[model samples]
Target: MYIDGKWKAGNSDFAVTNPATGEVIGRVPDANEHDIEAAVAAADIAFADWKKTTAYQRSELLYRAWELMVRQKSQLAELMTREQGKPLKASLNEVQYGADFLLWFAEEAKRMYGQIIPSARENQRFLVHKSPVGVVGAITPWNYPISMITRKLAPALAAGCTVILKPAESTPLCARAMMEIFDEAGFPPGVINLLTVQNPSRVGEVFCTDPRVRKLTFTGSTQVGKELNGLAATNMKRVSMELGGHAPAIVFPDADPVHAAKGLSLVKFLNTGQACISPNRIFVHEDHAEPFIQELTSRASRLKAGNGLENGIGIGPLINELAVGKVDGQVKDAISRGAKVHTGGQRLTEKGLSGGYFYAPTVLSGVTEPMRIYREETFGPIAPVITYRSEKDVIAMANDTEYGLAAYIYSNDIGTAMRAFEALDFGIIGINDINPTSAAAPFGGLKNSGLGREGAQEGIEEYLETKLGGFAI
Candidate 1:
């Protein structure tokens, strides 16, 4: 673990195993409360000088980091694949995505603008200045480990706030690798600290309640996000959460079935459907549902599941045994509830691949709203396709869930697409586009999904607090 501007081993160590093969690839230090305290204190100390540094200086350092990341992209990608069980190509893309944020935010740092407010008095002018929120506690999840870390760190750094990062225990290697790059890029001591620990709840409590930490940014499930929000409220610490989602992808009868199927397939199973933005439910018009289901099932059958490092592997295994079991249970539950399994709905137990945690891409038809898979978040390769007769019914169904992270609409009609885009209650809506998240756009959720946003100008603002100043010039 790297803490207090230095890389040092912890008192105790924990094993980081490969989710696919169940092999221990590396060991990460289990950071205790003392370690968390040290990391937080280091960030607190670094905040004064880091925030005081000129925006140009901060931007230059971030650019250097971005360049270094690009140079070391392959290594980082390999680490991500080894730890997170994502395909190598996907892993590489994540590394690039991670670097893009740093590059984008580097430019954004210089553009952090304050506002001049009109004053009531003739002699006085009101000026609003944005300043760093002080030490930030960043807790990131296992899926898309590298990108998640950078998404939080880039904006926090750009805002001149020092951070203490707690990466998920399942995938610590990628975080460690990124920290090594930060070291190589010559970030000032205490600017960014990394702590690896198994007990995230304990570490979160320490970080959230600590007076030194002024802001908390987390990416995980809704259940955990709520706890963190409450914990941070005690100290009135600023919070930014990018939590869970049960995103809906609605396919219209007039839309091209092939195009819509392909687009929805990519988002439905990307990262094995582990992403918060991954579309969990598919609402197809009854007229087009059959052909759409057939095409989707065929596409899923062709996907080759194997080790992420190997070439031509379209899909990889679930992150661990627990994830596989959860997916399996959901499939069985749906089946028991009369949901028709079109193809691949069970764990893959073939020879040579038995050691890894693998599940075949699953699709279900005739799924009703009452089934667990219909309304709940089954964060796996399982996609439930629900058919609807009317646009009003589908729209209401899409907005039924508490989660409102993202929604997808596939329609050739401009007016219909516009209505869906406007009526759908989601933070990010995509029209005929499967992958909508980018460094240039704001990404987040509404309602129970999360609070605040990540990426673009909105992301950087979460780490900063505005102060108003008035004086007669």
Candidate 2:
């Protein structure tokens, strides 16, 4: 972890394991209350100077960081695959995606526009400025570790705010690698820090209650987001949360089933379907349900599951035994609840996967709302197909869950697509697009999915405070 511009260790440590083969990768420093407090104090001090630097200078620093990331892409990607268990190609892509954020925000740093307001009185003048929110504490999850950090880190630094990050225990190496790159870019002491501890709750509590930390951003489960949000409310600290999601990919009657299946296969199985924005629930019009299921299942079954390092591999192992259990339980429950497993159902204990926690890309047909898989976010490679009759019914079913992060419309009809796009409660609606996330777009969700946006113009707003100045001449 990077603390006060130094690569150092804490009094304690925890071993990071490779989920693919249940092998110990390495150990990360396990921080304590003192370490957490020190990081917050360092960020607070660093913010004093970092906030004073010109936007152009900060942009230069971010650009340097981006360059460093690009240089370390192969090394970092391999490290991520070993620790996080995603495919080598996906890990490499994640590094590039993470780098893009830094590059994008390096330019975006100069675009924090203020506003001028005309007062009712002729002699009065009002001006609003976007200022940094001071010290920030960011907590990101295991899935897409580097990508999540860059999404927040680039924008926060670009906005002239100092940050301290707490990456998931399972993926600490990814964060550490990024922090090393930040160090190479010559960020000043205390400008950015990373803390990993055995007691995450305690560290998180400090982030919420500490007066020195002004803003706290998190990407995790909704239950934890709500808890932290409530605690942040105690001190009235600014919060930006990216929480859980159960994304619905709706295939209308007019849509081509083959085209929809082809697209869904890519996004749905990415990261073994552990992504919060992964299309967990599928709502297809009944007329095309059979064909959709057949095509989807055929594609899913053909994908290979094994160690991420191997070539030609599609799906990888789950993060741990717990993930395996949760995914397996969901699949079993769905089957017991009258859902039929179309293609792949059981866990893989075959060659090259005997010691690993691997589940085949599963598809379930005859799925209904009563099944457990229908309601829960199946953070696995399981695609459960639910058939619907009309636009209104599909829209209602899509918004039935507490999560409203992202919803997809695969219809060719302009009117139907527009209606579904407007009616869906999710923050991001994909109109015939599976991967809707872009560096320039505002990325977030509505309802229980999350609290604020992470990319685009709105992304910078999360790290800044609006200050209005009034003067009478």
Candidate 3:
């Protein structure tokens, strides 16, 4: 890990295992309280001088980092695929997306405009300035290791806030690689610290409790997000959390089943369904459920599951055995509860896939709200589809969950698409689109999904604190 601008070993180390082959790829530091404090303290010291630098200087450094990321994109993606278990192509795309954040924030850095408020006194000139929130502790998840860190870190650093990034233990190499880019880009020591720790909750507690750390940003589960929110509340630390999601894809009667199915298959099974925003529930009109199911199942079956490094493989191994068990259990419970398994409901134990944890892409029908698969976040490649008669009924079922991260609609009718998307309670909405939104728009969730947004013009504001002042002439 790089701490205070120096490469150093930790008190203890933990093994990093590759999910594809179940082999120990490398080891990262098992950071203790001391390590977490030291990193935060370094960030605090760096923030003093770092925040004073002009936005142009910050943008230059960030742009250089983005360039380096592009240069090393392939290598970074390969390493990420080997570690995080996403397919090589997906990993590469993620790296590219990750680089785009740095580029976007690089340009957005200089555009942090403040407000001029009219004062009650005629002689007073009221002005508001946006300043960095000082030291930030960023906790990113393992799913999209590179991009998630970049999305948060880019904005924070570009906004002149020093950061201590605690990347997921399962995928620390990508974070290390990013630190390399930042160092090569000539960022000052302690301006950014990468700390890899096995005890993430402990490190997170330190981040929440410490007064020196002014802000905390995390991307993970809703349950964990709630706990961390409570912890951050102790110190009144500014927080930006992107939590778990149970996204629903609503297919209205007017849409083309085949097109919707193909697009849904692309996003639904991406990263083997290990994404927070991955479409979880499939709600199709009763009239089109048969064709939609056939199209969706056909597309899913075409997605080959194997080691991420292998070409032509769409779905890879689950992160670990636990992930495999979760998917399997959900499928099993749903099946036992009268749900029909359309295709690919079991695990694959072939010679080549014997070692890794690989569950086949599954499609389930006759799903009801009482089934386990319908209730939980089945973070795997299983699609439990439920049929609905009316738009009003499906919209009610979609908004029934506590999660509201993202919702999808596939409809040719503009009125149906707009009205349905608006009625569904989610932060981001996608109409006839598989991969929803872009780096140019704000991404986050409503309700239990999360707080604060990332990306677009709104992203930089999360790291800045507005200061309002006026002086009478």
lDDT of 1 by residue, 1-473 (tens): 89876888888999988877888899989988788888888888888889999999999999999999999999998888989989999999999999999999999999889999998899999999999989999999999899999999999999999999999989888999999988888899999999999888888997778899889999999999999999899889899988989999999888998789888888888899898888889999999988899999999988888889998988888888889889998899899999999889989869567889999999999889778888788889988999999999999999999999999999999999999999999999999888888998999989889999899999999988999998897
lDDT per residue as tens, model 2, 1-473: 67898877888899999989988989999998778888988899899999999999999999999999999899999999999899999999999998999999999999999999999999999999999999999998898989999999999999999999999989998898888889989999999999987668987899899999999999998999999999999999999999989999999888999899989989999999999989988988888988899899989999999889999999998888899999999999988888999888999998979888899999988888888888888889999889899888888899999998988889889998888888999999889998899889999999998888998989999999999999899
| Stretches of model 2 off by over 4 angstroms after superposition | none
How many Å off is the CA of 177 in candidate 2?
A: 0.6
Error of 2 at 382 (Å): 0.5
CA shift of 67, model 3, Å: 0.2
Model 2, 96: alpha-carbon shift in Å? 1.1
Q: Rate the local accuracy (lDDT) of all candidates.
A: 0.91, 0.91, 0.91
| Clash counts for all predictions | 0, 0, 0
Q: Looking at model 3, which ten-residue stretch has the lowest summed lDDT? A: 431-440
lDDT of 3 by residue, 110-154 (tens): 999998888888999999999999899999999999999889999
Candidate 3 ranges beyond 4 A from true positions: none
What TM-score should be assigned to candidate 2?
Answer: 0.99
The 10-residue segment with the lowest total lDDT in model 2: 196-205
